[model samples]
Target: MTPTAPDRLVLVGGTIHDPATGRDGVIDDIWIEGGSIVARPTDPSSFRQIDCRGLVVMPGGVDLHSHVVGPKVGFGRRVAPHLARSPGKPAAVPTIHATGAAYAALGYTTVFDAAIATSAAALAHLELADLPILDKGIYLLAADDVAVLNALDRGDACETERLVSDAVRAGRGWAVKVANPGGAVFWRKGRGDHHDLDAAIPGHDLTPRRLLERLADAVQAIRLPHPLHVHTANLGLPGNWRTLLETMRSLDGRRAHLAHVQFHSYSGGDLDEGSFGSGVAPLVEFFNAHDSLTLDVGQILFGETVAMTGDSAAAEHLAHTTGVPWVSHDLHLSGGCGVLPIAYKEKSLIHAWQWAIGLEWFLCATDPWRVALTTDHPNGAHFTAYPHLMALLGDAAFRRAAFDRIHPAVRKRSPLKDLDREYSLQELCIVTRAAPARIAGLPQKGHLGPTADADLTLYRPDRDLARMFSVPAKVFKRGVLVAEDGHVRATPTGGTLAAS
Candidate 1:
């Protein structure tokens, strides 16, 4: 049994990479008291000091976008039971207990389920309660509600704001997420024509563009900490880059967060595999210029993993093309979700292109602070692949070697070949922890400074970025030692972070 954490402790002589406080590779002593980082005590003898000399320290990771729990996640497990267990490997769709334990073991202290229907928020919350160690929250698909859509259609800003605010409060959600906007409405009607953002929803006068604008207005008016979280139209479709670009343009300087942008950054036309390639260059240019927008890569690692999304239409398209086992459920008025098992092969042209495109987005972006590293969790790849993705971003030589092994067509056509920009440890910290926490509106998380939550990870540095990040020397959750050397030492019930 693990002993309870001491109330006063100090992690001494650690090389810290706290980007939020501008401490880059600075050796410092971190003082903790009552589950919070505090200034050094006047009486040094009173605090227990643990020597952390030679170890690298950073804030506990914050996953701003992931689908760790919810009814759809339950469905995903049911559909692919084989994904639940793999000898010496983390499950793609882990059980609630494993999900929490794995994330905590990896030094992630906080996570947000990026796409939970507001109607299923209570159920998601109940599941999250069982997910020990990580402080968790959910982004509600509130825009799918008929009443909200109706208000948006009628251009009733007051009603839209009231309805969105009410749903957020009722569901205890962290932010408002619109998955494919009116795509589900079309899906329910057995129609696949709503590819254009300006196309009308069959039952409503509102287009996807208008819905986005109204939701942004509502989210802003409600004074929510996080902006409207958007998964734009035509996700995973070739030539969807246009839709993604238009989605950003429609925001019109309003604060918003784009989800799984890698899926949307494609240049090819419908079913044109030959024309399919990276569209990230232009997207990155726009993203760099727009301070109102921030994004998570949804980087696709070459692997076998489940693809799940609240965007049922996109899932259906993938299912039909790949001939994989697929499951989709309509959540009545609150939209729908789709889940499927998929294998991204290194030899497959499209898969290789996707891999290159995600990396291109990571490499091309001018600001690491506006970007968050994610795999869209079991969509592009499993969350467990984050360490590997980190290695790809931080080590350009490793990236080139990996790139050379992929499909030759991608080698010749993709722009990822030319980009050699490597992310430093500080940039990695910003993308993984600081940026995500700030984007998620959790200022207290993703930093190791005075008055901040005393959640952090200490790693014995290694030349191999993947090996260094795969296991930490020690992991702390609110000052309590929870994991050490990739083993879970304690299972503590962490608090739920909700937008008040």
Candidate 2:
């Protein structure tokens, strides 16, 4: 069924916090017409007015990175059936139906699955079609194609650009993504020793660095809204911070987005337990200085969540280390992914440091425009943890108490012990809605400026940021009231937001 526009509605007398327009906490009425925000209509009787005198209004949230659909997510659900049958509620990997309802209830109107192999684009889109109330798109795993690598290896930049453009167009994809570029060659060969970003592809001349440079160039040349989304090589390895730094440098001012960066920012080498700690300082400094890079910190909250990624080697390492039931599958020559359940314990040094380093990245970064808030969904933690993560970022006292409970060694060595920055409400808005929408190339979805989509969240302000954000008083999706007070009022089929 085709989606129809809602009746004219007016959210009256709300304290609007539209960061895009610099309307900070100003009391104003917002008008909606034909599924888009508009100027006040002339005929007052045509509108249904909702009194929002004490409510706080902002653009509906945008999740820039998540693993909400496709084969790997399905595998996660099948492998851990008990995960969805937890005593209190369902699993971390929610079904397609529940995922949409859950996100809408939390006030997010848009979400992008960060990695989808080109081969699985059809399957993923089928699943995404079932996702309700949120506009969705996927970043095609273009760089994982053998032909794409061969083009780069042969120094055919034009061919590489054409291949990327054609793949995205055919797949109806939103952007290009390269997960552990050239790492697939090593993984197929079972060469665990070739974990370095500089290492050459086993059968080709292309290295991960070269692959990134060429792919980044292609993404820009094609004039795609998003830069190439990269899950850099050496993910989850000790002393991988150097690898991440090198990966950023390889872009050489070309725009590219680094995904799930917390997993790639560890300080240790050789997987030694003692050598691991916060390695975010140097990376954060370089990231702040480099204007071309944008990232999402996959913040880990204490709990059980599935770790799933297209980096097969990293997934294998994690599965082996945890000695847990895991699954990995090859997608012909377009790379692969692995999934395993992980429990982050405050008493575990590595897990505690992971929690701290993610915060360190959030606190130390100088610009909110270049950063996005995410858990890489089900990787670092579930997307539902966003409210808790926001609380940790907004309240220093709450953060310190959580910090004190973590492993003692991490408390001593991690830089989070001294960082005093607490994100203001406006800043949190940027990371969650504004910056992500901008980064994802969706100009109309992130703000309440006239001509933007009528997707908004209204909350009754409270001292507790988590409680305030966890249950929005009202949510509007394209001018329709889809959710109210944490319950689904209407289930509208969201559009598949792919590039033409």
TM-score against native, each model: 0.98, 0.97
Candidate 2 lDDT = 0.88
Candidate 1: list runs displaced more than 4 Å.
1-6, 270-274, 331-333
Residue by residue across 139-257, what tens digits does model 2's lDDT show?
88887788888998887989998998999998889998888888777888888776676778888877778888888988899899999898888888888888898998898689999
**What global local distance difference test value does model 1 have?**
0.91
lDDT of 1 by residue, 191-227 (tens): 8798889889888899999999999989999999899
Alpha-carbon runs more than 4 Å astray in model 2: 1-4, 42-45, 270-274, 331-333
Residue range with the least summed lDDT across 10 consecutive positions in model 2:
328-337
Specify the highest-TM-score model's number: 1
